[model samples]
Target chain A: MISIKDLSKVYGDNVVYSHFNLDIEEGNVLCILGESGCGKSTLLNILAGLTPCEGDIPKLRTAYVFQEPRLVPNLTVLGNLRLIGADEDAARQMLASVGLDGLASRYPRSLSGGQAQRVALCRAFLFPADLMLLDEPFSSLDLRLKISVMQVFKRLRENKRITALFVTHDVDEALCLADRIVVLGSGGIAGDFSNTPSEKYGGNSPLRERLFALLSGN
Target chain B: MKKYLAENAYNLAASLLAVVAMWLVWIIAYAAVGNDYLVPSFWGTAEEFFSLFAQAFFWQAFAYTLLRTAAAFLISFALGLVAAALGVAFAPFSRFLRPIIAVCRTLPTMAVLLLILVWTSPKTAPIVVTVLVLFPVIYSQLTSSISGVGGELAEMARAYRLTARQKLSKIYLPQIAPVTVAQTGANLSFGIKLTISAEVMAHTYTALGGLMSEAQTYYNLPRLAALTLCAIFAGLIIELIFRLISRYAFAWQRRAEA
Candidate 1:
């Protein structure tokens, strides 16, 4: 479990967050859902200790997948995977899992956007970390690629039960991927919900409607 | 296949045209001067070139000069890599090195050669001068490229807990290889030229520059021109070899570009 308290972040004249606090349970997919510039990615960066913030964050080994793939352009797909200590067989298997088989020797520049992102995802998964951070990873992906990528994440999550903090503005992405959803607004938590089976399958979940209202500022 | 052949033929024609132009200029100049000592006939210079090729002393001189240049170049290359690494790892040290790099960049190669000759023996002076002339160029190139390795990749490396060696070989080298290849391509010829120039100034015993200087003293214009042409041929051959090696070394980049 990770706990953050009294987080305050400011950049010159712009105030990003003030007295922000969050708690995430272990082995849970917690999505920080928000609109543009709602401090979602900033929160992730703060948690990762990349950006300056006054807060108490739990000491967790973290793997981050940025909005861009951020791959070494000169390295082949498998080479990038091996950087994180994945061996040849494991790297190849991971690539195949993301539908990128036979691309082990291809450089990042040679890969399509979707394929590159999948490589980034594989890199994140291959790293030995207690927590994973994703920043708008599927935002630039097409619908089909997004779904396939989501499935990749789903399969990995099911297999490893790795704790994750996924940040995004997409409502459907949060609905499909997160075990718990935390909506951020006005530099603080606006709505927080934990999903249950019936809430996902039953006629119309109040949680979904409430989340929509909260997101739209109704 | 036809297009490729046509391209090759055109290239050959262009090269021949260039040679013909040079020959015409040499003939015209020789005709105007009417003195073999001042302006050798193209045929006379050509004959000297062939004769020089047959001489063991010429090959020995060429080989010795090449060996010295390669030694100096390798030293410069190694020191430059270390300097760049130190600069990246420590900002204060990098700041300390900037002025020295600037001086090396701006100082005349001849002046540096003379200064080096005062301390080093004539035999080693050329090597020292070559390093001085080339170190800043190679160091600056590597430092800038090393610094430009993105923070994102660094962070990624950290997240993965990559060992220092892993980070260097996997991330730093891959990122820096292109710029390094480019700088090496441009500087290799310059390094060779500087080495020969330094050899001449230092009065090195077994070098093309020494032979050229000797020819100049005796007014052996044809022999001088022949040696000069040999130097040009050496530079061209070295450059071509470097290009081929770089293409092979960074083949992944070519693939990505393709």
Candidate 2:
């Protein structure tokens, strides 16, 4: 389990998080749903060790999928994967898994938005990280592209089952991918619930409604 | 291959046209001046320029000047790269270098040459002056390029736990290569110009600047014009070589553009 206790983060006059505590179970895909500027990204950054906060945060090797693909422009697709220690065959295999086969030699500039995001996903999965921190990885994509990329992400997550903290403002994304849904508001986690088997079936409607209400309340 | 050859041919033609335009301007200027001592005729200067190749003294001076310029450039580049890297790695160091780089950038080259000549020999004065003049330029270029590696990429590297060697080879070097190459070419040419000026002032007898000084004392305008032309051609050749290196070294950039 990954634990964050007594996390206090402040930027000058603004307090992003104060004494915030959360425990993430192993192998659980925790989706953090929040409105804009509700400390969603800050939380993920804290987990990724990119941000300094006053807390007892577990130190774990993390794979990050940022809002942008963040691939090195000069590196080929496979070369980018190889940058983080992915071998040639394994990188090729991972690229194929994300439907980016035959693009091993292609640079990031040649890849379309959706294709680049897929490569980012491939890179994140290829790295042997104990935890994955994804901050709105599909936020920039159009709806059609979003759905396709989300499907690719879902397939990767299912295969690896790495503990992930997926931060997004999209309710549908949370419902589709998250094993545990968290709604962050001004005070803290306004709502938290397990999206169990029953919730995936008929219970989804009420759960979605409740999440929407909680977000609007914020 | 056809397109590449056609492009090269067009560029070569354009460059020739520029040279012709320069000669036309020189011919007009000579006519306006109407004095051989003031503005030697283009043909006379060209004859002198070609005849320079046969003289052992001219060759020796050319070699010495070339050697000094190269020495200054290599030293300045190395110092700049090391300082820029340190500045990038440490925020306080970057802050500390700000004022020093500012002073170096604003220093008067001739005044600094006078001071350096008083302390160092005439042979070494030009090299020192060129280093002092070009160090800030190379440092600023490298610092900007290194800092421009993008915060997103750095964060990504950190998150992925890329080792120091990995970061340097896979991220920093490739990101900085294009800018560094262009800056290196420009600085080298500028270094040669500054070195020549210092050599002229210091009266370095075995350098191109000393030859120009000799021509000036004798009022041999044609030889002086010829030496100046040699400097111009040298600058152009250096720029072209670097442009070719930039093209081939960063071929990935060209492929991306295509």
Candidate 3:
């Protein structure tokens, strides 16, 4: 579990967030949605302790998948995996999980943007962290890759209580991946819409148009 | 294969032409000056080159100079790596050490040579000079490499609970190896030059710098030309070796380049 209370940050004259409070539970995926320059990524950085924050973040280790893959270009696929302290076999397994089994000896520069993102995703998941902070992890991925990686996460969350904070600009992505979609606007946590609507709803509760209408009308 | 050869053939030809043009200029200048004592003709210098290459004394000096350069590089390399590791692992230490590196790197080379000369033997002066000249190069390179190893990747490492040694050997070292190789090329080439320059001043026994200094003192033009050629050849060889190392060490460079 992680908690943020009344977190505030300013740059010169602009306020990023003020009196901001958030709490996350283990095993559930929480998606933070906002446009560019709206401090979504900055919020993630503060949680990861990359930014100096007025509020406290949990002491437990959290894996962050940055907007950029941020992989060392000189390192091979296996080398990148080894960075997270994964064994050689574990590295191979993770790569295979991401459909990168043939590119073990390959470097980041050799990989396409999608493949690089997959490697980054695999790296974060392979690392044993209490929380995984994903900032647009699949933003560069094509349709098929996106769906596949989402399935990978779905499979992962089944047996493991692996908490995640998946950040994205896309409303659909928030719906597809997150268990609880926290609609963040200029009002950050404007609405807490549960995508996992039970029984007859079968998880894909409200349609995109209906959700967009609710967000706009509000 | 054809594309590769076609791309590189132009560079080879251009380099060849440059060498030929330089040789022609040397011939013309030497002949026009008509002063064998001051500047020997092309053929005369070429003969001396062959003669020096065959001499055991020249080889001994060359071996001594190489060993000294290697020692200086190894010393600076180890120190630079340790300093960089410390700087990266601790921000406060990096802040403390950065200014010292900037000052050392920017200090006058000739002044450093003079200071070391006063404190050490003629032979040992070259070693000290080589270290001082090379320290900044390796240190700055290593620091930049380490600093560029971003916090996001480091957090990923932390998430996995990687041991300190694993973090260093697996993550830190590979990230820095390419940059270190690049700096090694630059520093080693400079190291060879610095060692030779120091040798000229100190008149260290069995160094090409010593040979050049002796040539200058006695007005031995052919010997001077031969020794200058020797330095160029040695510097070129060292740079080529580093070039090879960079290619193998950083495959990502090749991948991006292709």
Error of 2 at B213 (Å): 1.3
Where's the lowest-lDDT run of ten residues in candidate 2 chain A? A196-205
Sort order, TM-score high to low: 2, 1, 3
Residue B241 lDDT, candidate 3, scale 0-100: 84
- Badly placed stretches (over 4 Å) of model 1 are A196-218, B1-20, B256-258
| Runs in model 3 lying further than 4 Å from the true structure | A1-19, A23-25, A52-57, A88-91, A142-144, A155-161, A197-207, A214-218, B1-4, B82-115, B150-155, B158-164, B256-258
List all candidate RMSDs to the true structure. 3.2, 2.8, 3.8
CAPRI grade, predicted model 3? acceptable
Candidate 2: chain B TM-score against the reference chain B:
0.93
TM-score of each: 0.90, 0.92, 0.85
Q: Could you list the chain B TM-scores for each candidate?
A: 0.88, 0.93, 0.89
lDDT of 3 by residue, B1-258 (tens): 687679899898999999999999998888788889766888877899999978998999988988888889999999888888788779898899878888877878767778888888888889888888788778778888988887766865654566788777767787777767766777778888899988998888898888889889998888898888888888887888887797675667676633
Residue B140 of model 1: what lDDT? 84
Looking at model 2, give its docking quality level. medium
Candidate 1 CAPRI-style tier:
medium
> Better model by DockQ, 1 or 2?
2
Question: Which of the numbered candidates is closest to the native, going by highest DockQ?
Answer: 2
